[model samples]
Target: MIITGEDIGKKFGKTWIFRNQNFEIQSGEITSITGKNGSGKSTLLQIIAGYLTPSQGTIYANGDQIDEQKHHSVFIGPYTEVIEEFTLKEFLNFHQQFKKPVCSIEEMANSASLPLDKMIGDFSTGMKQRTKLITAFFFENDAIFMDEPTSNLDDEGFQWWKDLLKKIDQRLVIIASNDQEEIKCCSKQLNL
Candidate 1:
């Protein structure tokens, strides 16, 4: 898939978070969005993921206008929340009703080193981040948007994240982060 944007701009009331932005993201490649804090990096990613609308621009995917409800995309970020009431296995099962996972629940749990029976609410920050990454990466989606993906990761988790990044092929993966390791794995970059 190819996602293209022209003159993308976003405003909150009287203030403009970003304006007159243009870019493209294609399948089978990873694109990193980088900028300092409060620079609209997350807002841009949200707009691309169809969660937010641009103030004065157009975004299209494969020549068709993009819509959040219709597009098969997932966003992983520091604010992305997990089901606190569900165990790891249950959460995976619940997610299966919406999208097919890239692997079995057991496999995902094993890969993330998560205990299947543990509730998501009890997991540590690193574990929660790992869970989010596993869920986002293992979904069969056309687009994946991530913001500050390595916020709560440890050294081992960083390695796992890097390894997972290498496996992201044939999908439109856009990441918004300042982490050098994450940016280094991307084939292209856009600075806000």
Candidate 2:
């Protein structure tokens, strides 16, 4: 899969978060979107993920215009919403109804060191982040977009994140982060 953004820009009211941004991201590579705070890194990522529309220009996935509903892409971020009301097992089961995971629920839980019976609401911040990462990584998707992926991770969790990236290295992975360690695996950089 190849995703291309042509002269992409976003504006809120009178101020432009970013303008005239362009990029070509393809499968089997990791790309980093880097910039300081309030520099629109996350905004650009959202636009690519089809969660937000750019004020100008267009984004094409494999030559066709992007459509969130039809696209098989997963977005993982510190703030990415998960069902806190459901237990880990329940949540995974629910997710399977829509998209199948690359592994079993037990395997995912074990890999993340999360308890299947525990409610997501009760998990610590690091654990929650693990949950998000495992869910996104193990899912069958063409693209994975992450924002501040290591926000709440500890040393071990951080290593787990890196290892998981290797396992899914063939997929199109784009991350929006300022942390050098987080973006180290990226081969290409899009400086916003």
Candidate 3:
């Protein structure tokens, strides 16, 4: 699979996030988008995920142009990662209701070390992020776009995330973060 962004640019009022930003991300590999806050890290990701219309340019995921109205991309941005107050089981049920899979949630949870009995509202931020990532691993999508993936992860959890990315197949993992460790682990870098 191939994800190509050519001369991608975005603007909010007079604030131009970035212009002529380009990248060609390949399948079965991880790529990091690095930049400071307000430098368009999240904006660039949102544009790729088809959440926002770019002020310029276009993108193609797996050789097809992304449709902004459709939920083709698995967008795991910070604001939409998870819902509050749902128990882990309930959350899993909600997530699976949209996509049927070969393995059960229990199997996925066990493999990812996610808790099933705890309330998400009571879980730590890192745990919450892990739960989201675990859901992403099971989601039905060709690509996964993660914004600040290591934001809430602890050292161990971060390592788990790193190792897990190395094993996924057929899916493109595009991460937006400033984390050095994550950047090092990725095969390519999309510097914003």
Candidate 4:
């Protein structure tokens, strides 16, 4: 997949979140979107993922214009929406059931380090994050978006992210993070 944008901008009231940003993310390489607090990093990712639209300019995914209602990219989803009521296994199962090019049940469990029988309702926040990561990774889409991946992780968990960063394929990842370390792992970067 190839994502390209030019002169993209957004605003709320008088606060200009972003303006005139240009970028392109391609398959077979990992791209990181980085910036400081209030720099519109999350909003930019949401736009690229087709959840929100930029006020001006254009965004193309795979050479086609992004239509929010028809675009099918997968996101790890905001932390707020992760299912706290479901077991980790159950959650993965539910996601796989609806996702296109879904993976087998066993593959989903292993991809996210989820113990197929474990109760996700009782998992620690880090564990939950891990499960979310797995779900994002297991999805079959060419474009995958994640925001603030290290929000609740510890030092060791951060290191794990760094390690994983090197291994992520460019053909499949777009990470939006404020952490310099995480952004460094990206083969290329787009700053807003």
lDDT scores of the candidates, listed in order: 0.90, 0.90, 0.79, 0.74
User: Which of the two candidates, 2 or 4, achieves a greater lDDT against the reference?
Assistant: 2
Quote the lDDT for 171 in model 2: 83
Instruction: Judging by lDDT, tell me the better candidate of 1 and 3.
Output: 1
As a whole number from 0 to 100, the lDDT of residue 149 in candidate 1 is 91
Cα error, residue 170 of model 3, in Å, equals 1.8
Give the worst 10-residue stretch by lDDT in candidate 1.
64-73
The TM-scores of all predictions, comma-separated, are 0.96, 0.97, 0.89, 0.85
lDDT per residue (tens digit) for residues 66-89 in model 2: 873366778989788889999999
Task: Compute the lDDT of residue 143 as modeled in candidate 2.
Answer: 90
Candidate 1 residue spans exceeding 4 A from truth: none
Clash pairs for candidate 4: 27-171, 28-170, 28-171, 29-170, 29-171, 30-170, 87-120, 88-120
lDDT of 2: 0.90
Q: Per-residue lDDT of 60-155 in model 4, one digit per residue for the tens?
A: 877778883354456764454677788766787678677753567677566445577778777778777777766555566667788978776777
Ranking by lDDT: 2, 1, 3, 4
lDDT of 4 at 56: 86
Please estimate how well model 3 matches the true structure, expressed as its whole-model Cα lDDT. Answer: 0.79
Cand. 1 Cα-lDDT = 0.90
